[model samples]
Target: MSMNLIEKDRVATINPLKTCQPLGAMWAVTGISRAVPLVHGSQGCSAFVRYCLSRHFREPSEIAVTSLHEDAAVFGGRKNLVEGIQNVAIRLKPDFIGVITTCSSEIIGDDVIGFIKTAKGELKEKIGEEAVEKIKIIPISTPSFVETHLKGYDNTIKALADYVAEPSQPNEKINIIPGMVNPGDIREIKHMLRLMDIESIVLADISDPFDAPLRPSTTEYKPYYPKGGTTVDEIVDSANSVGTISLTKYAGSGALSLEKKYNVPAELGPIPIGVRNTDQFLRNLKKLTGQDIPDSILDERGLLIDSMADVASRYLFDKTVAIYGDPEITSGIARFVGELGMEPKLVLTGSKSQEFVKDIEKVAKETGAEIDTMIDQDLRSMEVYLKDNPVDLMIGGSDARLMAKENDIPLVRVGYPVYDRVGYHRRPIVGYNGGIQLMDLITNTVLEKYYEPEHWKLQQ
Candidate 1:
């Protein structure tokens, strides 16, 4: 049997592992309060992002676009961008505007920053100095050719940090960068921090806004700007934080850059997915804040350990798994699996970054697990590897789940684009409590397959 089942042609035929860049920028901006994201390119890009987010979050995701036409594409999009910014300003009156560059705009080398500067000038003229001063314009360049959605999210956060944070005297607050997690995960992280008596500012928090309960017909569905996101005031005061903690190393150089620029100390850690990772996260938090772990956290930790002990002998040892997603998420899950005495046989990410590869290597070496790591890898290549060398289970985003299903493999869904399952916007996979939930999901899925009736089993 050959482990090269996926041929070059088949691999070419598979859809890409990563989505378009503008969608990433859109996702980031949606977390902001009363903020409008304007894509500086074609209409389809904006429509696609809105549709995708609406489907996943089960809410209307509002965004604007330049509506690039043949004329704009041929000459320049300056006029369209200026008009689009003005229109959003006049209509939505958002507190801030997040401008994202699309593939077409990047290809044409559109002067997005210049357009924003020009729009700011016009806004000042139209709304007078006082009103214009209150509004903030954040311009993010997301060239699809250069990076994936993961990179886009990191870059946008860095841009936000640069735009709002100023140097200040260090204080007791902590800056928390939770990378691309669900709203529920964000809320849980904040809850855990509060319980530890630690104050933190979580950038782009969207829990309440995105995960609100359904209401009756008479009630109105207001846009989720008034309740979500890190406030502008909070962002301006971030330089005063005593230290910065990033949930995922893949949050990019932005977090570290903020630390250096503001003279704030920094700690890079994995996403708190399972017991081991969550424990490490709590320990780091305690070290940074110089506070003991709270009793509530201890209880949660105890419960997680108890649950793990119950299932460890049967499911934890000598199992093999495959994982693919955003680079940092893949690394975090891979480490968690290894800590449980399982083999992360293959780890893949569509993103091409040195930091991603380095993080994976570091984690794999520490866990003594053999890893086949791939950067900028596509789904086709992953499918090939799966055919060549099968694993006990797979963990990934929606695209990987489809591939897993096609291969008749049981998949534990995590990460972005979890379209097959409901409540993706509220899926919690961080903190001690989150770890237990994730482990339960993984163990139950594995056991369900293992305990299938003999008659129902396939006869090859």
Candidate 2:
């Protein structure tokens, strides 16, 4: 955990691994039922978001942009903002229109709150009473220059808590707050809850909506956003749950806030990437619900244990690795690999937070695996660390491909913005089953490196 090796960020960023905040806000918007995500800034910015989402999720995206021009940037984008709101409302008839501001709008001093308040009245006049009555425009001020996309995701979730959660009789159900996870990871969480016979509200769940089958099921597109999402009704129901289990602090900061305001007890856990973390995750749930750990679930746990024992000596024991990705998952992987008797030599993440380092440090101590960590870092910095402290394997998203190539190491894709690979949105990397899936990938990747065809010398 040394910062002395590389100098802090100065002028230029070489191959930045993270996107701007508005894109994350757009991703968050897709989690709401019948909600249209509208960006109040340059159309290109929104287009890039759409492109990235569409490419990563392999689904059609309907992110609307304000298309700010030179004149609008110079003077103001107030008119464009109003017009864009009216246009999206009329065209999509969305039950809720999520508006996120870009750098352009933020720089030009466009008053999003004032513009939307005025637009609300005009909507009632232009559209029928019934239409405007149900419509809601939520403005998320996400300026790209100030924070990373992960922050945008967290802020938007906080906004949902502020705008939607309400008080009611506390129910047996629970709230699950997931941060910066792909669809497959989310589905695994839902699957685990179902296995425990626990009903949970998964905020910002994109599992079904983002990865719906493309076999032509719907007649036409309505304000019904997509095939699946956490509804406004569900968001309200979160307030009445017995407690909230935030999967990651990045996106689940809202859940903590809900606990503070609504008095719902909250438990914080990192992303359940491996044996130790997943055990903690389910044990917490079992404690909350007071449900018996079903035999079926126990059997799955046994299988994971058996597999870990099999691989410890043969493939994973004493192996050295490097990992970089979202903070929660990066730490989870370190914990998991540590359990497998592997040394996570270098742990890195582009996001900034002191808490991230502390969590990984605990894993380092547990495994007796000495580690160095970097937060608020870039791929360029990761390259420097790799040069100083080389490892056998590298794990991260597509952006780390160059780092892998430079070091001549196999890179296992994980985390956000996995552009080079397909079906990342559908790959489950959490829970007991997810542990098996991950072990298969890593163990085989190591075996593939060790396999020597020349040594086998098959008969010709």
Candidate 2, residues 161-259, lDDT tens digits: the string is 777788887779988878778888998898888888999888778777788765554566443457788887888778888888888866677888788
Q: In model 2, what are the clashing residue pairs, if there are any? A: 1-372, 34-225
TM-scores of all predicted structures: 0.90, 0.93
Please give the lDDT score for candidate 1. Answer: 0.77
Regions of model 1 farther than 4 Å from truth? 1-13, 168-171, 214-226, 453-460
The best candidate by TM-score is 2
Error of 1 at 264 (Å): 2.1
Q: Which candidate's lDDT is highest?
A: 2
- Overall lDDT per candidate, in order of appearance: 0.77, 0.82
